[model samples]
Target: MSQSFAIAVVGATGTVGETLVQLLEEREFPVSDLHLLAGRDSQGHSLPFRGKNLRVRAIEDFDFSQVRLVFFAAEASITLEYAPRARAAGCSLIDLSGALPLEQAPRVVPEANADVLDTLSTPYQLASPSAAATALAVVLAPLRSLLTLRRVNVTACLAVSAQGHEGVTELARQTTELLNMRPLEPRFFDRQIAFNLLAQVGVPDDSGHAHSEIRLAAETRQVLGDSGLKVSATCIQAPVFFGDSLSVSLELESVVDLVAVREALEGATGVELVDAGDYPTVVGDAVGQDAVYVGRLRSGLTDDAELNLWIASDNARKGSALNAVQLGELLIKHYL
Candidate 1:
């Protein structure tokens, strides 16, 4: 008989959290019992899984000991508050919030940093990197050996869904009003988001870099296990509703070979490389897909050592929920 275990999904009402539940069912994970939990405001809601609706309960009163594994899919503060409790109850956890310190949680992307899992003991705790980093890592991990990697610069154009349901609603409202020629008022975003791009995703620090940018760089390096690697990241809010698009430039120590790079990417896991002269876009290529789509592979006109590429990925599903579930799968297979 196959062994099954009890599992809990925190923030079960949110976008990523709901997707986590769906993937768990779609992948046929060995979940004997599933607990859907959220804050008081979200309590009483229900989510369907395996042909049944599971009622969401309040996280505060739930006993962590009942579940062997828990997914922290809510905001960072929620994870900060409850993760330790889960840990104290001997429940292994995977955090998607990027709240816990790297030294403590240690980010893990199965494709790039599965080895990191081997270093940890039982009751594993891991972080699923940001959407940008996850996509970058998946595309870059296989290429690390092909090139003498020096620096990577990325401009991530993310969909409004990155901000959660409110951002989605705001975009829809703004777009409808604009189409109807109604007066526009910005709410969720600082300025217009319909048919527009906000250069920054979140508030910028005194250094003028948004928090998302810093997190992208830090998380990418951590997952790649190359702390000293130079990473320049810029996250912009795009008006789109779903996928994330990235423009990546890599500076290598020696001249890059386009043939070798293409072959490497084509053979890489979790990657779908498009043919030359063709490009992948969020709507047509990446949304709702598991693979990270890469195209527009070319070398710098002046700098032979530079390589540039375009990436499209599904941020909500492939990036956040799926990765966290993969971490749970990894834990069950070995560490747990």
Candidate 2:
């Protein structure tokens, strides 16, 4: 028999939040009753669910205890303020904010770290990595079993949508305005992002690497369960609108054949491997696709121990909403 549970999606009106709800319906999750939540401005707005429209409620006024599962897809600031309150109310939390700085809770990419569920005394809490991090982690996870990942260096080309709808709009607006010979006014990013790529995705610290770059290494290591793995990241904000891609170079503990490594990645879940003959691009192949598309597979110039690959995936779907939904399914299967 199927089990039904009350569920809530906070930040229900945003890009990822809407994607999460869409996935819930498409996957036919056992949702008995659904709640939609947002900030005061968005409260009273209507979002479609299960056919009819579900009225959005203010997060401050909603009771968390009414739902068995709660997905925090809201802005990080909003999530930071209310997540603890919801956890205290006794519902399982799947945080997608990536801003969750809790040391106790694991930030998981479900395909990479389903084992995390086993460690949790209860499925009442977990966090998901950002879209870019998820893209990088899922690709590297499968290769891990065949070869011990000693070190990894990633250069991520992130979509403007990483910042949300505003980022996308900002890019479009800037591009159109620029083409018309109008001055581009930037709001969502640090600089003009229509035709240019920004080397740093987020504010840089004293170390020279931006926050997103720093997060990539830390979160990838955490999700891959390799705390000491030497991982370096460089995050670039690309002009594209939806998909995120990564150029990954790995230094492994032992030598691996090209066929063996490609075969390993092909067999990995949530990963789509494209060989040398075929090419995969972010806009052409990865947009609207759930799986991480990996191509440009070959040996790095250094040696047999080094492997290089290019990967792309939908930042909104596979990166945030889909991963959270996958973990939500895991919670339903194991704990709920």
Candidate 3:
């Protein structure tokens, strides 16, 4: 007997949103009735799932009570407006947008924090950690258990696609225009992100931290359950179409050998250890992959009690949509 249920995918037009739909089908999520919802402009759109086309509807007209689960792939503002309404109508909200009220909703990374399942009294749950934060959190999970933590410093080279489909298209368009010797029009991004790297992922605040930096720091700490975890973040938007990479350094309370570190990483779920000769890169390795491919493991040069790592993963998959779907599986097993 196949157990099936009604599911709604809000924001089906977005990249992460569409990825979630694919993952849901790929994972065989027992989706008996699938509802695709998007904005007014996308109302007539149709997306393929399991070889059939599902018509898209305006989300403003969606009836949440009819669905058992609502996966919100919409913008934070849209989620804010409707998540509560969906919950009020008796549906579990899989908050892929990372916009849920943090204190009220448990931010779940199943590989790192499955304990959230034991305390699942709330209707809201987070399906995302900032890609930088997700990469950092999964890597840190094994280390946090082995050593007393001190501080973590990371620089994330987020792909241009992190901003959405427009970001990807803009990079392509600009590259073509530059090759044709035309003047670049910086529209989607604040700066020329065609062939160059922007040191900050968003406009800086008074504290000199970009929006990505702040989100990475705060979300990393929250996901790790370490309020005092000293996280210093530097985020840059790299000119790649997909995959996100991170350079991470950690100062621990004690020394850990590289061999043991490798063993721990290999044992961790949603993580994979790269061999010494092969370094993990965005294009060569991580795009379309589910594992957080990690390499460049070495003893910290300056400090004996520290370690360094280079990590990469598909920002759209393991970082966001896949994590959400994995959490949804947990939600079904424990609560639903």
Candidate 4:
């Protein structure tokens, strides 16, 4: 480890990859050199970094030998192919893919489980959860800190942008075509995504939960350090481009007051509490913002210990890239 290290960002042309670059520069990480690696199709593309243009290099040709940190924002297949090479090259790998195991890899959210990165003996680290799950984890962190979370139920309205640029473009294209009275076809999704919401994001598991929902439940429990805590989730794909909104209900062991909840949320890092009478925050309003916006807080009608909340965040930033960058920062500060 070095005070000034060379960093490489794989899948530099994708949505999350681009955001990672932006966050790295915005946070002023000590980058002695920055390398952007993309697929062959995106190799010649140029991206801006700190007011300077950086040409993308094909991942096949990029050398990881001298790189100290590698951010893998590419697909799982790409990660499986290159992650080992990067690790063997002696670089610390931070994976944003779901291909890695949670227990062994220590799936991480900087605001939730940054401590996991401190004792990493392996050359790679798996960033935990998806954008939707990450937002829920952040919102729940404060609540879990105050009381024992007995059960959590979440319904996530996730935007197509979580699928990457293709999903976003398909949503917009289909919307425009529909507005023009053209026939709609499903390409990025199994069904129409324009002006419609689908209750499925991934394949259903044996437990009858979609993969996204399962990941949310499992990752939330992991981040909260309560494996025995019960959780159920329903994941839906909305027409929006970025930001994910979650309606969460929690049954806690102790009663929680609204005032205390508001105070805790307001004081929590990377979170903003919106009081009543304000416009309900939407997905568009949350895009590009790093803070998790929480509002619509209420108590259960029949249960004093139960609480409900609406939480939203830019899935790509707070949920993915920005969080990964923050993890890198934490690793450098505490571990390196």
Please list the Cα RMSD from the true structure of every candidate, rounded to 1 decimal place: 1.0, 1.4, 1.5, 1.8
**Which residue pairs show collisions in model 2?**
none
What lDDT would each prediction earn against the true structure?
0.92, 0.86, 0.85, 0.83
Model 3, stretches more than 4 Å misplaced? 122-124
What is the alpha-carbon lDDT of model 1 when measured against the actual structure? 0.92
lDDT of 1 by residue, 100-145 (tens): 9999999888889999988887688888988889999999999988
Q: Which residue pairs show collisions in model 4?
A: 108-128
**What is the overall TM-score of model 4 with all chains considered together?**
0.94
The candidate 2 region of ten consecutive residues with least summed lDDT is 98-107
The TM-score values for the models, in the order shown, are 0.98, 0.96, 0.96, 0.94
lDDT of 4 at 92: 84
lDDT of 2 at 16: 92
Residue-by-residue lDDT tens digits, candidate 3, 45-141: 8889999999999888888888888888888888888888888988887877767766756667777887867866656455567777887888888
Q: Please list the residue runs of candidate 2 whose C-alpha ends up more than 4 Å from where it truly belongs after superposition.
A: none
- TM-score for candidate 1, residues paired by index: 0.98
